[model samples]
Each structure stands twice: as structure tokens, then as C-alpha cells.
Target chain A: MNTILSRFQIEYKPFRLDIELEFPNEGVTVIFGRSGSGKTTLLRCLAGLERSSTGYLRFGDQVWQDESQNKFVPVHNRPIGMVFQDARLFPHLTVRSNLNYGYRRIPPEHRKITFEQVVELMGLRPLLDRRPQRLSGGEQQRVAIGRALLTNPQLLLMDEPLASLDAQRKQEILPFLIRLRQEMKLPIVYVTHSLNEVLQLVDYLVLLEKGRNVASGPANAVMSRLDWPGKDWPSTFGAILTTTVADHETEFGLTRVQYRDQSLYIPEQPLAVGSPLRVHLLAQDISIALGKPETPTSVLNTLPATVLEIGPTDTPGSSVDLKLDVGEPILATITRKSLAHLQLKPGMRVYANVKAVKMVHEIEEY
Target chain B: MDPSIFDWQPVWITLKLAATTVSVLLLIGTPVAWWLAHTGSRARVWVEAVVALPLVLPPTVLGFYLLIALGANGVIGGPFQSVTGSSLAFSFAGLVIASTLYSLPFVVQPLQGAFEASGKTYLEAAWSLRASKWDAFLSVASPMAVRGYLTAIVLGFAHTLGEFGVVLMVGGNIPGKTKVVSIAIYDHVEALEYSHAHWLSGGLLLLSFMVLLIVYAFNRRLPVHLS
Candidate 1:
């Protein structure tokens, strides 16, 4: 669905968060940024909670805000569900009543998602009768999510939904959220700073820095770019590669993946053929090979690639990072001794001997 | 003890006067106190000073001015007499008016304290939730400030009940009409009837203490925080 998301440009006294962003209207569009990078402020502006914001905001056909026209829809009238970092469940309300409160507010004709389905989706059936004060942090956040979903909002805005939970609680609720994303026909704008969440869940990425749009595109494309804020190489920081499982080598404890007429192997993983997987390649683990060597090596994935770019090394003997454009972008870190030995140069064909293609996780496709 | 010597009419008149006075004070005081608490205007301090005038003013002086203003020959009372065919002074209604004036601070102070304790956040939260102004006030602000309303009621009623000098000065001792319990007790002592005075004093003491005890005990049992 070609749903039109707004371009937000807002300025407040002493601070300003100005960025242009287009939401996907489906799946999870993560506004990934560090804390204090104006992620929450941007979400609040979209929710109409920050009325003083001067900008144009439109979700599909509806106009939430237009400063020149002096038109601004208040928060209650906006058909957008917002889940805060802290859940913000009314302390005075029971879980069932809290869910019902929002449900009762929506017009009868617009109520597509039922209360029972929402409760089941969030796994909140047992805690329906309990008050918010009695639930654990994770359970409370789940109830908050269920409550928002039952409202049948046009879009859901989650501002760091898992930030408040500990590691164990985050693990507990993440699968439920993934299920919600897969099953529900809801478009979500999920804001987070955690790289793990960005790697696992995001389909569309809107990277913000200091109130400015840094990069925006599909998750894998944007995340695989070198020369990003901190790192000079994609793998030096983090690299997400899309690959499909080819076969499993059970005796050798290896799983094979086919990419560009090459069979690559990772540690034994539980995955099926045609299942997409994202491998995290560390730059330090990759060694460049100018010529194909006929010798036994412990390394698994070795693919022939053309050099795209190279950067200077920090130490005397350390090799520069060579940018290799493959099915997805990859980076190779080689020593100056190895670089001279292989005679590596830009646009020259070389082999990237990957020591390991760390099986990050199997990205469940929607 | 002795019904004839006791003059039960004065005791009954006093109860009626206190009840009427407390009701009038509450009706007038609530809105005024609410405004004082909510308004950011510099004039609030001036209004507050006026409300607290009874606390510092000598009862006889206040009573004298009220008497002149409502007396048969005075400017307001003369016009009032021509319109209503009755003077304001020396009447049961006059006793209520005087008692209300003396008890204004007791009602207003407690109400102000209660309102301040309730805070503005509760009202704002309700407003954001799409509750109409009236709905917000009824459902949120009023319930949040309930302790203040209770305190206002109790203080206003008790202060009116105990009024003596102001009521006597404005409301001449008309035995069956204007003579309240305080005036009745004073009359008993002036006539050397200690038994009748003792009975009225003991009854008022018991009633005031009971109201106070109820207020404190009920407040203690409330789950929500109180002022």
C-alpha cells in the first residue's frame, strides 16, 4: 500500500529535531538512533502530543498537522496508538479495564481487531483481571501493547518498547512482538537505540543523528555501508548480509549457504533451505587472497570479490580494510605483509577468505 | 434540667441559625476559594486578605458595621425595608448573615488548602483523555479535592455553631427567633441560671468534638493521600 507518511520538520526553543522521513505504512519502520538523538521527540510530534511543533504531518490521506493552514488534530482525535517506554498504563485501572477503555472509545464501525485477539496476541489472558501495579515490567508492557492494539489505530508508534525491560524480559516479549508484527495488518514505527533490535526487526531504517536525517533506506543496504558515523568499514562496525541456506553438513557440524554460485558454511544452525539469514561479519576475521589457493584451510566461506575501496591502516604492519561488493557488501581486513603478498588493489579481482560467517540469527521473513 | 427555665426555643433557633449560616457560607466560599487557588492574578492576594478579615477584626466592630448596613435607618437597610417591607437587623436571617461573615475564614481556608493539595496535573490528564471540561471537573477535580470539601463543610458548620458575639450584636436577643445557643447561654448566665447555661455548653462541646472526631477518623481511613 502506497500510504503517504509525513515529512516532519519541527523546532522548539533551545533544541530542534528537524528531519524528513517516510514511513512504510506496513511492517516495522524503525527510527533507529541513539538516546537524546530526538527519536522520542519526533514520535511525540507525530502523535500530536507536542502541539507547539511547526511542521506538515500526513499519514496516508489524513493531515495530522499543517502549520500554514493552522490545522492541528489533538492527540485524542488522532487514530494513532502510542506505546511509551514505560508502558504508562493507568495505575488505577485493571488490565482488562485498561484495554476496554481504549476499545470503548473507538467508533464501532472501525473496530476490526477484537479484544480477545489482542489479549491472545500479547499473551495477557492470565493478567486480564489483575491491576497494572500487580504485573511485572514485561507483563505490564505487553498489556500496554495489547491495549493500544485494541484501539485499532491506523498506525502504532512504539518509543523504545523494550528499553525499560531487562535482558531476560526483553527476550520474553520480543517473540510476541515479532508475532504481532507478522500477524497484524498494522503499520508500526518502532523507535530504538539497541543495535540488536535494529538488526533483528527493522525493515525500513531511518537513522537520525543530532536532529538531522543521517541515512534512510532498506535495513540491509543502509546498515552495510562503510564510512558511517564511527567506523571506516562496514564489518569493522557491524555487517548484515542476506543469504539462503543451501544444505547442512551434519557430520562436519556445518550449514551451507548458496550465494552468487558459491557454497558458504557457518557453524551448525537450525535453518531450512530458502530461509533467509543475516550473518554478522567482523572485519578482523576476513583475510584477502589475490589468487585462489589450492590448500586445506580451517576457514569456511571463501568467495571471489572485486575490491570497491580501501582505507589506510592505523598501525605499521596492519593491512587496510578493502570494501568488497558482493551479493551484499563485505569488508576484508588484511595485513600490509599479506596485502603486498597478494598484490591487492581497487577494481582488482580477489578472494575474501572468511574465517567465519557468524550465524547472527535467522531473520523470519514476513 | 428544667424545661421552662431552659427556654428550649432559643436552643432550637441557634441550631437553625447555625445550619442556615453554614449552608450560605459553603455556597459562597467554595467558588471564591476555588478561584483563589487557581487564579494566577496578583489580585488573589487581595481577595485572600478580604476573606481572612474576620479572623483579625474585632467581632463587635464587624457586627457594628453589619448592623448599620442592615439596620432600619441605614442606606442598604432603608432600601431593603421599602422593597421587602422588613428590616434585616434583629431577625433570624440577620443572625445567619452575621454568623456566615464570622465563619468565612474557617470555610475558605480549608477549601483553599484542599484545592492546593489536589494539584493541576489531575485536571490536565483528564483533559488530554478527551474528557469535556465539565466531565473533567466532576470526575477528576472534584473527587481529587474531596478532602478539602469535607474539611470546608466541617469547619464551616462548627464555626457557625460556636458564633456568639457577632450573632448577638447583629441579631438582638429575640428569644423565639434570633437568640442562638451562644446567646442563650449568655442570657442564662446574665440571669444567674447556671444549669441552663451548663446544658447548652455541654451539648455544643459534645457536638463539635464529635464532628472533629468523625473528620479525623474518616480521613485516616481514606486510601488516597490527603492534605
Candidate 2:
């Protein structure tokens, strides 16, 4: 199988990390969770950084670790590249030599990436001769990424690679990551706690909660699922609407999308028609109506959706969450009073007014 | 210029003893410093204190115990004599052991400090890039901790070069065997040979000053992270 299979169980003084996960051998598979949830611990186990962990970790047909059989491969022997949270670049080596250190270690036959290619991809030409200490955090991380890529690993592991950067630096680094995801065939197993990273980068999503795997699936499917096992809700979750540009209105500066039997509109972009786009719609931004509005409304678009379920109200006077089927699943939340007045029921069709899209990734991705 | 009043043998002996002592201390002290820097055991502080005892105790006090220990009837000296059929007290081999012990903290402490400061972050980064454990340490860890190595080497060598009391108690004033420069200078001063004392003392002072100046100059130019 073209997958990375891992099963690790380890116990610290008062904590334990137990997981069995299969990461697809393509695109970015994000192992996401809140802090202290063993997200990093899991990544370390895959890298063989945590030696005491037992059970098996198999990458494709090769078994990297199997405790019962006394089989284990050290971190350096595994064909995996890792990017840590902080840019732990070598202080003594210049950026060029830091990139070369790993590149020289791998034999020519296994070096699938050239030095020039990595330097170009990571935008490292200007910083090659400079010491790592002189670069900004983002630049250091870029060099860190470039250094790892030159090693030509089969699998790349990223442990919160952008967590150390500020908001602006994070934005500066995101496009490079997106391009890497789009271009590279190497499977990337990324660990992160940022929901924005999950929304923007993840192709496949694995949710970890308190040292346990709570949910695992495609990013959009997992994001739209309402009944989250942990309290990973509120601002932490949102529906990921994967759609394509059906048409563009140059005069209005908007792009139209056809979802199911209805259409929606997004801000105009310089994207070709039929390009893949992912939109972020929070539950609060979507409101449901009983009938299709014929009156003039400011809302840009409305879609037909069948109510699959109504979530329980957390407080007596709070809003009720709704799960909708609009070709792809999306979430909506309305106040309890509104729910009673409309007399909503499961399987009943309604019109969804998408007032605002929280964010959008017009990224060229699957 | 009589051989009885003037000799270059003491200078050569001191240089040889210091060089040999530093080499022996480096081989043994590095592992100990590495362990102290990385290990989390509760006994670390105690072990560190014992290693630093020579730094605080009077050379005479340390030499007193070593004197008994290397004596023919003492514990180590008894077995050593039987194995080698030679006495350790007041000998060149005995002088080397004294200097290694006295100069140990100078070698180990700076190295320990460096290892602790650099930590394992860069090493792990290298391992991720397919560098083996030894390669990562040599390429990543050692270079980052280079200032520590430099400090340790200079202090160990200079400290051994300037030994006076410990050598006096352990090796004594045996010509061609244990009459190091420090003792020789003292002998000259006692004999009121002012020129001989000034020449030896001035050279020792100048050599030490020059070594420190070079190290400090080089430290500023290195690209090592202070943290």
C-alpha cells in the first residue's frame, strides 16, 4: 500500500501516547490537535526520536519498527525529512553548507532533488552565504525546509513548522508550502495545532484529542462533521467548502460557483474558470430560511440544503447548530428562538443565505 | 653560564608535563563532562562537586593526600609498585597524575557549560537530514560547542604550565626528572640569581598573556551562537 502505517504505545511518568494511524502516500496528511495532546509525540515516534515507544511503524512495504521482532531503524536511516517548530539551523554553518550537509550524505542515485532546485523552491539564493544566525525566523525556517528537501526523503514530517513565526512571517511562508504540496510527490505528514493551517494546508486530516485519535478522514469531510468527539468546536471548527469556479463576471468582479442545485458567488479573482477553490464558511455566517427569498436581499448567494441533524443547545437560550447537505456537507447555526418559530425538522429542505465567507483558499489543489 | 647554575631542562620538562597532562585530561574529562551535561541523574551535582574539589582545596592539602596515596604503603601506590616495579612518589609519572587532577575542572567545566548551552536541538535537526549520530555530533554539536573546547584547552594547558605547590609536594626538586620551571625559578631566586628568575618568570607571563589574547580575539570572530 502507498501509505505510512504506524502503531505506537508509550507511557511517561503520568502520561501515555497510544496511536495507530495510516497516512496516505500523497499530498499533506495533517495530524492536528491542541497543545499537550501528543501531536508532536506522535510525529517524533514516526521519526524514531522517541525510542521507548513500542509496536510497529511501517512505511509502505518496509517495516521501520516492530518491537516484538526486535526491529527498529534509527532516525538517520529512515528516508524521512523533518522540519521542527523552531528553525534549529546549525549556528556554525552558513546557509549553503547547512543545506549541503544532508545533501552530501545521501547517495547520488537517491538524490531526487538537485541543490539548485531546492534553493529555487525555498527562495534561498540570497541567503546561501549568510549565517543562520543572521536570517529572520521565517528565512531560517525556509532554509530549514530547503535543507530537508535536498536530502530527498520519501516522506516529509513537519512539526508545527510555522508555529514559531509571527502572523506576517506565517503568511510569508504559507505560499511556499502550498506550492510544495501542489508540486511534490513526496507524502507530507504534518503536525499542527493551528486551525488556519488545517483549513489552508491539509489534504487529509487526522484529529487527535488527549492522546487519542478522535476523527480521521479527508479534510473537508472531517471539518464539516458536526458531532465532534472532543470539545473541538466553537472557533476551532468550520466547514471547508470545496468548489470550482463555474463562471466569472468581469463587470461585477465576482466568480460564481454551482453547488448542488443552486449557485454561490465569491469575490473576483484572477483564476481561470473551472479552477479548484476551497472556501471557509463558519456556522454563524450561514443562516437558513424556510422559503427561497424572492424579495431583494444583500446576501450574494443562497443554496438549497436538506437538514441532516440539529445539535443540542449548550445553554438554555443559546443557538442550535445544524448539519446540512449541499452536495458537500456544511454547518449552520441559528438561535433557539428562530429554530422554534421555523419548526425545523430533519430531512426538510431550506434555503441557506451565505452572508460571508470567513476565508477562502483559491489554491490550485485537490 | 655554568650548568650547575643555569639549565633549559626545567623549561622542557614543564612543557612536556603540561602537554601530556592536558592530553590525558582531555581524553578522560570529555566523556565525564558530556555525561554531566546531558544526564538528569540526581548524583550529577555530587559528582560535579567532587570533580571541582581541586579547584577549591589548597594544593598542599590535595598534595598531602596524594602524597600518602602514592607512597609505597598506600593503597594505590602498593598495587602500582608491584605491577610496574617502580615507585610513584616523587616521580615524573606521579607529577603527571597530580597535574591531571589539579587541571581537570579547567578542562571539564567549560565543556560541560557548552554542551548544556547548545543542547540537542541542532543534533536532532542533523539527524532528520540523514546524518548519523556521530556525524551529527561532530558536524553540528561540536562546532556549536567550540568555544567551550577552546576555553577548556587554554585553561587546562595554562593551569598545568603554572603549577608550583602541587609539583613541589608530589614530584619534588629532582633534576631532569621533576625540577619543573616553577620550582627552578624558585631555586634561582633562593640562590639570588636575579637574571635567571626574571628571564623564566617574564617568559611564562608573556606566553600566558599571548594565549589568552589570541583566544579572545578568535572567539569574537566565530559565528557560534552564545545561547
TM-score of each: 0.71, 0.91
Per model, state how many residue pairs clash: 1, 0
- Report the lDDT tens digits of candidate 2 across residue range B1-227: 45476578999999999899989998998889989998989999999999999999999998988889988887878889999999898999999999999999999999999988988777798898988988987888788899999999999999999989999998979999999999999999999998899888988999899999999999898879666
List TM-scores of chain B, every candidate. Answer: 0.93, 0.94
Chain B TM-score in candidate 1, rounded to 2 decimals? 0.93
Error of 2 at B217 (Å): 1.2
Candidate 1 lDDT over A48-76, as tens digits, reads 76764457788887877888899988776
Interface RMSD of 2: 0.7
Worst window of 10 by summed lDDT in candidate 1 chain A: A229-238
lDDT of 2 by residue, A20-96 (tens): 88878888899888888899999999999886546798899999999888999999999989999998888888999
C-alpha DockQ of every model:
0.19, 0.83
The residue ranges of model 1 lying beyond 4 angstroms of the native Cα positions read A1-13, A230-236, A241-297, A300-326, A330-366, B2-227
Once model 1 is optimally superposed onto the true structure by TM-score, how far is the C-alpha of residue B73 displaced, in angstroms?
13
Q: TM-score (chain A) of candidate 1? A: 0.82
Evaluate model 1 with DockQ and give the value.
Answer: 0.19
